[model samples]
Target: MNATAQPLVRFRGVGKSYDGVTPVVEGLDLDIQEGEFLSLLGPSGSGKTTCLMMLAGFESPSKGEIWLGDTLLNTTPPHKRNIGMVFQNYALFPHMSVAENVAYPLTVRRVDRAAKAEAVKRALDMVRMNEFADRLPKSLSGGQQQRIALARALVFNPRLVLMDEPLGALDKRLREHMQIELKDLHRTLGLTFVYVTHDQSEALTMSDRVAVFDNGRIQQIDRVDSLYETPSNGVVANFVGDNNVFVGRLISVQDGRAEVGLPDGERIFGQMVGAARVGDTVRACVRPERMTLCTRSGFDGGTPSLNTMHARTAGTLYFGDHVRVRFAVNQQEGGFVKVPLDDESLTEWSAGDELMLKFDERHLRIFA
Candidate 1:
């Protein structure tokens, strides 16, 4: 997104509380760019759903302000917000036909018959559910009903769409298929989307940017790649993907990098995150895919072993396309290296094999 682009939605110091004393969402300030897919992702009770509810006007904010374009939305009712919503249970009326369900929003707005019919047709076509216009929602399969719900949300031409785990009820394969479909639809329609989900993989797969929430606070908000590759903290690193983390004392901090000392007196270097003192006990993290497993010979004379560590193979597990080799670094089994199936040379290792784990210094991240 362009930095200069004006945000279509803004949350300034937004907070939510049901019991008056405890907050579910706290001091949130976020700007969502127009036509971008932004996901509120976190575990349950982490305040992501509350944020969505506040924006959708289903729940009022206890403090702060929410703006849609230039309009203040704190006191606006849901129907007047011009925002479409889709939920996990499909929320379809069993008595209403698909077309009728899709036309409900337009009906509430008193749209003329001809225009409502045209919009209903276009929305059905967008979701490829034109043939099911006459079918009752109860007769439709889970995926079909989800499509109809989506079409209904779009039929009225809402300014923004909010989805809260709309695919949670579907089977795994169907859910994956819908993720792709939703992303493609978002790109084609170019509409602002705010999604709330607890599944990290689902958020990563569908969102252009993700706002990670925990304990009623947004820990980090950034592009998906940045969130995964360079997470802002330990919570995000562990939540977004497979991260190998170890506790170490910060030995030195120079320029943006740091030298860390392990309990066994071995030292490694990496880029430092946040500020840290020389003696501060810090966390060092690296992704599983970034570690390279090599035998002793591979790191001898030619390789100077700048970012190398001595590790013993704890175990190796196979997962169809790739194998994960767990390593005991400094007598602690914490790090792992992922090896592709086609790499035969790296697969013939036993649990007790003495090996070396090498990685680029830039791949390591130190968190204070």
Candidate 2:
């Protein structure tokens, strides 16, 4: 968001191609700031990994150029880049203990014994692994091993750190715990982090900004809250979170709003931008949590409401902290409403009941 300062890493029209047939990444332009945590999120074959590999010097750009601070990095080798990397498998040396593993990078650069030991100890303590410094990786838990790997990556105090699905191997609970720990570490170290992952929740939980990639291109990049609430297109809407999609056609445009007719016998109005006209096909995306369930007592026929949909409850799922109500929206089309368990009215609602779904106009996103 700071436009005046130069970025720590900049990619200007960067691209990659394997056989010179299809570019793995086409025309990528990004600026990653210092001391920020960013995530590249997408499904498999989306080119997120390809971009990370290019940045790490494992691969070269077929076209365009990459900049790290003041130096252009397209021709730089991996050893000269001074960037640390962490892989999904932890990548620890089996024969080495924790301290030794953390010391490998410093030893490779020919640092003296005293400096290497001090750096290793500081890195291990940063990740809370200094107590287990002498233990082999095989003797530690998955989370502990990951900590050792992180210490190894940070022991050299590199300016940038690239992580490829680094938390994928751990269990869910440990993964969540590490997410907080990693964010705190990044703050304390004040280093730039480029993380790659397919998990939307993980990205939303940890990233300062996220780049959503699809089909070998960057679809959208923004703060996590903006990306979830106002997705630029349908692909980003469905991929970033659980959305109830309503396919519609633009019927009219007035006062910066477009009227859309949904297939579920609902006519709605939503905000739109860029090259949309009457009779053009479009889509409306609404998040489940943004919907309000209206019972018969509170139901009103006429109001300033823009959209309404009818549904019959098919089932209810209790998630301990929240409740998920599944219903048939229109014929074969389905919908779900997620509500917190603290809502008192939901206690009276049961399966097979009729309900009206209402949503705020500000939360409705239209894509054409």
Candidate 3:
């Protein structure tokens, strides 16, 4: 992002409501920078897809304004907005050959024959689908079909590209392969890309920034590392990634840190996310990977500012690269600690064993 350039797209108090009563998207004020890969991420029916549709001009905003560069887009038709859209279903022409499908955008715009052919060839080559140009849509694999859709979207060289779960139909390996390709193409072409997906991993993999949406609103928007590491509230923390939440009351607060009392009467300390006085209810949020685990022999783990708990091991699930160990802290269950395969747990630990779990105060996030 540059220091002081105008945003490529802006939404100011923008809202959408089909019934003129309830809003699917309400009071959305967002900015999309030029040449950045931004992803709108959330769970189903969280207004992410509706926001994308509004920006693509498929759905109109019932209130407020949308701007592309300097022009207001309230009355602009879909084609006149000059935005390329790639959908979840690919939306390809099944009867057309690959080359013909890629050239459809050019045909609609009435580009000259020679220029349209050259553009179609370049777009197909860019997606590595030029060799399959003569094949019908059904003959290609899911990944190849996705590539053709991408080429068609890129053929006319639109101002911005919008993708709504474009890789949702492919297998896991193929989807990962396409993620890398899309990221590479974004870097090579230096064009603005706005993507929508419910997959947080995909958003983190491809986006320079992510807008996390929930209940018809944006909870937070920030860089991936910042959003994951320092979430603004409990909603953002629990939604963006794997988080273990402990309900507790504020026993005391000192210098932006809080001493919390859990249900079991144990006291622990963590960084307070916001201002809270004594005796206020709060939550302790911790990522599984941020915790440290040790056997009974190796832990004296209690201190004034550090958090330590006695947990009895229940079971372990292997994930090839990492192992997730589930345990019960006192009578409560659903606590997980992730460790690498080479950790001592593979050979030295088993179910029904007592382990001490400790974490630094910096890794524990407190929210009210």
Candidate 4:
């Protein structure tokens, strides 16, 4: 994120409110870099869709300015914005053929018949929908219809494309395949994309960066790896992946580590994440995969460090590639350790078995 690099789309203090009192998007300041795929990811009604609508010029901002390059887009109409849009339902014209649907954008702009045909052919080819040119919307499958919708968006050669859960209508397998295809298309065309979705995994798979929205505000914005590995807050940590939270009082803070006193007179050390002081209540969060589990006999009972925990196995869950072993520590539901499927210990574990869970201090994040 170079300070001087110009953004393709800029939202400056943007806010959107439908009822004039309750805002859907509040004070959103974001930058979509040139040729970057940025996803607005959140649960339903989290303002991600509203942000996309605002950027697409379908909905005007209640406050702040939106800029596409140097032009102010707050006053621009949707048709004049030179932006492509794809919706969850495909939004194809039922009466039109696939080719005709792809050419609809060009037709709206009064493109000549010859040039519109050429653009339609090229767009259809790009989406691998060329052979379906003669097919009507009703005759095509959901995936094929989505391809036609994408072709229509790209036919007009727009610099930016906004997609609102475009893959929502497809089955899981098709949606995954289309995610790769969409990423490839974005790379080939070098077009900026603003995608909206409630699916966290989809956002992580397709976007160069993700902005996570919650309660009409952005919770965090970062690359997928950063968001998963080092979430800025507990909300992000819990939302992005499986996190084990231990709420305790801070006993000490020194260097880059803090000590948290658990309920059962146990103090654990973890990497200091946010501002906290002695006597402050805090949460030490760790991901399931970071924890290593072993039988109690394998580990000597020594002075507790940030990395060690004693627990009893509650149960185990098989996820094909991995095993999640649930544990009960200090009377809390505590957390689970993720063991790889290849590990033979996964099958040996039983409920009520005492175990020691170990993790590196660096993997634990402390937040107030």
Q: Which candidate has the top score in lDDT?
A: 1
lDDT of each: 0.90, 0.88, 0.89, 0.89
Cα lDDT tens digits for candidate 3, 197-307:
999999999999999998888999999999999998888898888987788789988787788898888877888987777788888999999987888898775666668
Instruction: Tell how far residue 235 is off in model 1, in angstroms.
Output: 1.6
**Global CA lDDT of candidate 1, please?**
0.90
Candidate 4, which segments miss by more than 4 Å at Cα? 1-4, 300-306
Which of the two candidates, 1 or 2, achieves a greater lDDT against the reference?
1
Clashing pairs in 1: none
- Could you tell me the C-alpha RMSD of candidate 3 in Å? 1.4
Best model per TM-score: 3
Report clashes for each candidate as comma-separated counts: 0, 0, 0, 1
Q: Decide which is better by lDDT, 1 or 3.
A: 1
Model 3 weakest lDDT span, ten residues long:
326-335
Runs in model 2 deviating more than 4 A are 1-3, 301-306
lDDT of 4 at 95: 94
